[model samples]
Target: MTESKKARSPRKILIFVVAMLLLSGSLRLGSVGIAIASSPEDTEPSTEDGATLECVTDAETQELMALLRERSDRVAEVEATQAQRQKDLVQAEAELLENLNKLEDAETRLAATIQRVDGASSDDVSRLTSVYESMKPKDAALLFEQMNPEFAAGFLAEMSPSAAAGILSGLTAEKAYAISVVLAGRNANAPKI
Candidate 1:
């Protein structure tokens, strides 16, 4: 109504409008904060829209991975040891086979030598005697002792009886007696010349 009252009235209305705006702004801010607090935190990005998400730390996962790595290393070490042992076994088997071959070869040679030596003829005996005559009487006696009794007796029959007697005389009494005994037996255990 009055000029001063009109001016004061306009000021009060402005104050009221400002208060209402501030209250509305505060309510909007409060609602936004409550919505943010109530919402769930983002886990891992979803592979499917409805998929449940779980989270784990890097160090804990890495420790489990390290444990798996250690187990793999142990398995590798055991495999290596087994492989080495298998290789050693193969080597040992090869060595055994090689030794067996060498032994078989040696036995073959020995059998051949024995066959040649034991299967001598009368002419062979004469040649052997001639060779023996050049040797020491003791050595000759040893050869005669080792000879088959029948062959030695036949060879003795072929020799000059005097030479044969001399060689017999030269032998030790024990050997001479053994020869006489063998000669006397009709079933003497000796091979034919």
Candidate 2:
């Protein structure tokens, strides 16, 4: 029993010494790693004296520089694209406003042209009505018979009621009925407004 105790004591002492050495080594490594991780400025490689070669060959340092450069390039590219999009939006807004102004001008001109045509058409109808009123019913009836039913109806409608009645009385019953139908239906589809 005494021999076994002596033997176990030496083994325990050797294990304790080895464990202390390993703990010191691990603590040193941990402090070094912490210093390197804090910031690049803390241990940046420099050769201001031109003779000393700092640890610039470290892969982690090179990878950090590459990542910073890539990020800077991406930011610049995004800013340029944003600027181009703003310019395009401004140009499109200007073009759309110009088109809207041109459309308004065209609409005004069209309205004027329509008013002129309507005035001319009314003047022509007034003149024809006057001519028919001067003629005898029998003569107007002969002329109306040769005219399209729609055309005869339009002329009669433009005249005074008495004159239009005289002209209608002159027409053949079938001709008068057809013209009356056209006149009656002419405004059927007209908008109330």
Candidate 3:
């Protein structure tokens, strides 16, 4: 019984030592795996010669970079186009303002010319009226007889009441009636207020 116990102790001792060696070896392997996973150098793939090679960018990364560059280019293009449009708008506005100023100057000149013409025409009408007034009523009536009733009425309106009466007296009844009608109706459309 003593010999059997001694033999069993030696076997158990050997098995324990083997089990402890296996556990320690497995623990060392696990710690080495963790160290390799944490290190940046060990994360990269090595060539057949054991030399770590530089990683080429993946297709997705390259595509993303290209997209970003394209977007940047588009943004720059849009900004440039907007700037050109703004500049064109400013130029157009300036041209319109200049044209407006020129138009205003032309209008001023036209108004002055119109005023001069109107003054000259008014003076001519007054001179003609004076000339007719100085002539014999019979001669003036002859001239008025050939004139349109409305035109004669216009001249009569500019004359003194006595001068108009003298011209009307010299005119034929029908002609005088037509002239009188024109003169009377001229103010018909005027506001009474």
Candidate 4:
């Protein structure tokens, strides 16, 4: 029984050592196998849609480059449009300012012409009023009869009240009434505001 126990113990120790050596060797071989499998030279030819990995990578790179170029061109075109629009806006602003300046100049000249016309007409009215004042009322009424109704009304408006009254009294009733109506309605168009 002692010899049997001694033989079993040695056998168990040898088997354990052998199993440990086998496990270490297998682990080493597995790591080597993984390394070889991962290497480009030892790896299987991997394909997608019948194209190699390198070819797929190159195609993807080319598509990305084309997309980037298209985007870049679009950006450039947008920038150019913006630049042109800015230039057009500046020109339009300048033209508007120039037109405004021209308008102001025209308005100023028109105002001066109106002032001259007003001054001359008023001077003519004053001279005519004096001429009418110097004449007999009956003679002035004759001239007023020959005058346009609106024109005579304007002369009467500039005259003194007593002179206007004398002229109105001398005029025919129908003519006097029309002139009076024109004077009355002159301020009818005034704005309430």
Candidate 5:
């Protein structure tokens, strides 16, 4: 080969080597890029004036990059978990609120049922009292004798004074006394205030 061809061949080889190194990612070019396959001594950064600067080796940079990637992935995973937890909590809260509303509705319905039952019971008792008041005193006294003293006293207390007195007069002394005692003691333990 001629001298010019020999020289050009070396330049071409150098260019090919640089291109290969760049493609392989072993060599990097930037404002302050480094050769990953270079010696440790060559890893130090320098300026145009040859002033050395602190720098890490390619292996250390790669390790630090790996660690950074790992930390970033962990952070992303944590964020995803937190988001899922938040979503679950919101759903749980909504369910709890719905349950509370259902409970309130049940309570309202229960209150209405109880009030209706109480009103029906009161009406029944009032009608029974009226019927007893219209009966003959001796007839009412006979029925009262077979009733519990407290039960008899409840009916007697609801009657007019004249009707109650007439019924009492017709009852046996023992039954009358027992019913009277129950009526008298009904509010004995009640608060006066």
Candidate 6:
């Protein structure tokens, strides 16, 4: 029994040593495989046998770069055009404002002239009558025809009745009819004032 136990103990030690050596070898081989697989040198271009590898950009990448450049240029052009248009719009607004100011000034001057004429005519009934008498009948009639009926009526009343009648008689038939209608309307709607 002692002899048999000694023999089995030696066999077991030998098997354990062999298993340890196999495990160590397997770990070393696995580490080597990992190192080789992850090495940058393995993926680098090799210089051998007079063969050279050139890396070139793909067509799609080049086309994408060209399109980006074109888009940038178009954006720049649009910005420039918009800036120019804004400048033109500002200039046009300034010109329009200037024209409007000129128009306002002109209107003011015209109103002042009209007021002066009205003042001169209203302040002097004698002068108004003399001017009316001096003018040709036809011219006076035409001028009176264009005046407001109320104003014409007032001016006619201020004139001598004979002079007023003469002018009325000299007026065209249409002018006479319009004046008669205005006069009749005024009489019909006479106020207490």
Best of the candidates, lDDT: 3
- Tens-digit lDDT track for model 1 on 49-166? 7786666689989998999999999999999999999999999999999999999999999998888777765458778767766666666667677776666666555566566776
lDDT of each: 0.78, 0.91, 0.93, 0.90, 0.91, 0.82
As for candidate 1, its clashing pairs are: none
Rank list by TM-score: 3, 5, 4, 2, 6, 1
Better of 1 and 5 by TM-score: 5
lDDT of 5 by residue, 1-193 (tens): 8999999998999999999988767433542354434437556677999998877899999999999999999999999999999999999999999999999999999999999999999888899999999999999888988999999998888999999998999989999999999999999999999
Candidate 3 lDDT, tens digit per residue, 3-110?
A: 999999999999999999999999999999998878786466779999987766798789989999999999999999999999999999999999999999999999
Candidate 5: segments with Cα more than 4 A from true spot? 1-54
Task: Give the clash total for candidate 4.
Answer: 0
lDDT at 162, model 1: 63
lDDT of 2 by residue, 23-130 (tens): 999999999999778757655464877564556567978898999999999999999999999999999999999999999999999999999999998898899889
Model 5 TM-score?
0.67
All candidates: TM-score = 0.37, 0.64, 0.70, 0.66, 0.67, 0.46
Clashes of 5: 0
Instruction: Tell me the tens digit of each residue's lDDT in model 4 across 46-68.
Output: 57777555436788899999999
Candidate that would win on TM-score: 3
Return the number of clashes found in candidate 2. 0
Displacement of residue 49 (Cα, Å) in model 6 is: 42
Scored by lDDT, model 5 comes in at 0.91
lDDT-better candidate, 1 vs 5: 5
